[model samples]
Target: MLSYAGIQNPYALGKYSVEKNAKVMQRYRFIHESLLRIAAGHLPAREDWDIKVALGKHLYEDAEAADRLRARITELRTSSAVLNQEPDAALSLLMDELIHARNDLELMVGIYGVIKPALLDAYRSHTATTQQIVDQPTIRMLRSMILDLEDQLSWGEQMIVSLQQSGIYGDNGDQFKAGIASLLAAAGGIDGQQPKTAVLPHRIRSHEPYRIPLKSVRDPRKMGPVTWARTSVLNPPEDPVQRSLLAKMRVRQEEMTAAELIAAVLFSQKNMPWEFYRDLARHLWDEVRHALFGQAALESEGIDWMSRPQYTSDYDVNAPKIPGAQYAWLAIGIEEGAMKRPGKAGEFEFCRDEAKHPLMTQFQDYDWADEVVHANLGRKWSPDLIGEDISFVREIAKNELDHFWTEVRRAQAQWNEGAS
Candidate 1:
């Protein structure tokens, strides 16, 4: 018989029958959903680079965890559909409160300090209570998650400590502490109680109206307002004779980053499948990395990225309102346009042969690969949201791109006139 030293004769059989395992898996599924909701709600609303990247990383990890939990349920021969259902009412409320936190500090404290600790405790108890031999797979999964969560907790505590040292919260630390305490109490004093079934609202309420200002961009230092210019993905350089390949690459990456970031924020605001947000968040983070690649390249060339005059056109500015499937299609179109004939492949080839810069070649190669994946993602998700008419979607994407360039030219003229 499967046994452990501490497991008594009565409990040696393990706490999980098939039904019990399903129930536990269901609870874990709810927890994963809650984490995803929190990540999606907070990430787009944040402006600070540190917070944004950290939250983005956290979101990606949570998404992976959620995916794993669903797979585990299926492995146990249980219906993974329970994952699509509403989470415990109290857990949902806790997530809502965290999402609605007035500021980043409050959010960090509530999630890392209170919610995470409670979750860690519950997972520990579950692992301990579970039969080590019979439930080895589940135990192994929870243990792996525990390691990640511990790292997350450490990072969170450091963030809170840093905030305290910076005097950002001043005397309000006690207030924040009390707020966390209250949430923990409501969540059944850290160990977590069985969540009651409560009716879910028709619409999820947001703490603030989501808006992406036309001129907003995240940078490390304060710089003067830069005029936005639209550039072509097909032809990055209007005059290859004047501009270096590295320069063109940098600009292209920055512009793409801007678009990706904006799309991520807009998509997060909409009520979509959790999987959609998860995939989008991962893509958003990759775009950030791409932008950094450009930033690094420029700095290596003794160029101050912040001082460069950048221009964005009306299409890039107002693309957020295009709505639902169209928004996704815009991204798909861009990626497809870049990856196909006369596309980014040309740029990669040029960088590899003429530029002779290994790093630039490497970046472009990976970028090309990523866009292919994104195009496929767009193909997979966008059609269901709109319909299966692939040609119609492509046409809409083409028209939007044309409109975008037209706005860019007009905006350029207006900017030049104002400057002169």
Candidate 2:
């Protein structure tokens, strides 16, 4: 078999399985509204023992047919929530949760994967029967997804040609991939997730992309040229306290950036962890400017600065430890988490000219595309990256995910808690 860097190359099967897992995973999510509504209608508090015993037999029956109905769930509509079988209020919250899940029930059950068909088919069928699926916004979502995936696939296919030219696939692309299948199987040997015809993600586990939580998200602030410029300046200070505050801000930025760089080193590897390289490069760039931005913001303050944005503390357990982690936590889990939470994009000031916030777009982009990559890495290569006996690595990654998110929220609070 032709090898990229030499002896027994792997990752090809990981890539292939990752792609297929992604499509299956996405199909589960696309149809969630229908499921939420159905669950809400059948048993508003299905997790409650009283409700479970008395009314939620459907969840069990539904679980049995996970494979058959999941595809349909990906295409459920709002109207599906209002079906004859459902109560209106429960249905609303179902849409609300589909729109938002602050509770962990959804994450725990891994409902996004196998049982998706039950929800989507129910909603879609309701749409046709009840005439409630005509929202223009929903239609736009459907159309845009179709277009976006087509574009991604086009680019993915083109890149394969470049990959072929890179001296690795010396004309035996198929055979090369076949050999790597063994590597993937070896990797999979350590992977606890079994690729049953249906899919599921590790619930409550940090960095497991499918592990959805019902956490509320923070929105990114809009930075216009004037605002950006104003924040970047540090006016000369008169008092000793003001001068001291200036110094502290500089030190904080350095600390955060240094911590992030150290964590980046933890992910360093060549050839195999391709995305890790991109993450490392992006983080270094963010760190380079982190202190500069803080300095500029600090200097403008006429009064003594209270505190600098911290990147680590018991509080920042979920705060992003690195730039790539920051982007992933914010862009994937939180932003997408908002799609199912209260005040969503708007709550976070995810606005544009009141309409075109880049952060929101980035959130959507990461949620729909990169999340699949994140999850697949866990599912396909858990052994190789962390090792067969190393459950410790998985534990550590989740701890980091928790810290990374916590850090961002603290940063927001620090910024908001400023001058009256």
Candidate 3:
């Protein structure tokens, strides 16, 4: 529903608050969109090596952008200068924020300067003058970086301005001086060493005191995975065809797993959004490892299994997220291509798999986890970016559904021919 935005952080799957979640989502939107753009022009019409190279380079740039973001994450994570008034706490938190900000500013400038020289070399190294850079690789790279900066404005400058207007700062000196002191002593001394379990630093002045429990501990859905495990056992595929199709998928899993890490390294360094690529690599590893387990289960049935396309590519990791944005949930993957896909929501009725394996179930799981944050991203930042209307989010979901069903039917056709 409209409230699904709060589900953005599957890691914190149970946590919810319209305001806080929206802010987190705002950051995600900028990062996610920038990644998608890198692959827009590069994805070729055919599944060939050239296309793969283009995808890989696109992904590499996206990863570089994430690295750029990581350089600044420490700025947010470091101690807050005004930890709601802990005595001389003002002295450290106040001082730290400015110090951290300055360091970040320097880092930003350094990155820009290094990239700027690279851009210049490209222009000098090229065949045409500056006017003809429309197709130049260097220009495209610079454009990606510039767009990244533009997107950052959603929270970059605006957040700082909002902070200034809040009057946490004092006209004469740090307003938090006393509160900072008591808070620090309450937490521990400046040394970060405290006696046994005495109370140390946990208060900040606010309109209300709130208590919240960690949801991951409370939510059963947060468990390692329910569907695949349950489906394999409880709902075995009824027909030989269906069972055989799934068995093939099990074999493919091994192929995917075998190359997952190497694919990740190739994709990240050359093509993916490097920061996001790391996650893709790990997910690939998980899928690969999971495949072996699935194979073990199949071996029990005396099935000699061999599946999956033995191939490698350099493509953007987050590229899957884009399709999932339009079709199903953004799982780490979409198993079928457009023509090779499965069922529809309305026309198609469910068929028992005996052992359940919906065409793109991993993607479905991904959507369930990712779409929540994506929904939240729209509500959280659309007001600031597009102002008040969330029509775009609807369009996005519609597209994802369209793609999803297309693949499912392809899968179902495979099922129909194969399933008894």
**Considering every candidate listed, which one attains the maximal TM-score?**
1
lDDT of all predictions? 0.61, 0.32, 0.32
Predicted structure with the largest lDDT when compared to the true one = 1
TM-score of 2: 0.22
Model 1 bad stretches (over 4 Å): 1-21, 164-177, 189-227, 230-249, 252-278, 299-322, 412-420
Mark the regions of model 2 whose C-alpha exceeds 4 Å error after superposition. Answer: 1-367, 378-383, 388-395, 404-414
Ten-residue region with minimum lDDT total, candidate 3: 210-219
**Worst lDDT 10-window in candidate 2:** 221-230
RMSD of each: 5.5, 22.4, 23.9
Looking at model 1, which ten-residue stretch has the lowest summed lDDT? 196-205
235-283: candidate 3 lDDT, tens digit per residue: 4478875665454445333333222222322222333233334444333
Tell me how candidate 1 scores on lDDT.
0.61
lDDT of 1 by residue, 350-418 (tens): 778877677778887887787787777677666655665667777777776676667667777776686
- RMSD in Å for model 3: 23.9
What is the descending TM-score order? 1, 3, 2
- State, as a TM-score between 0 and 1, how close model 3 is to the true structure: 0.25
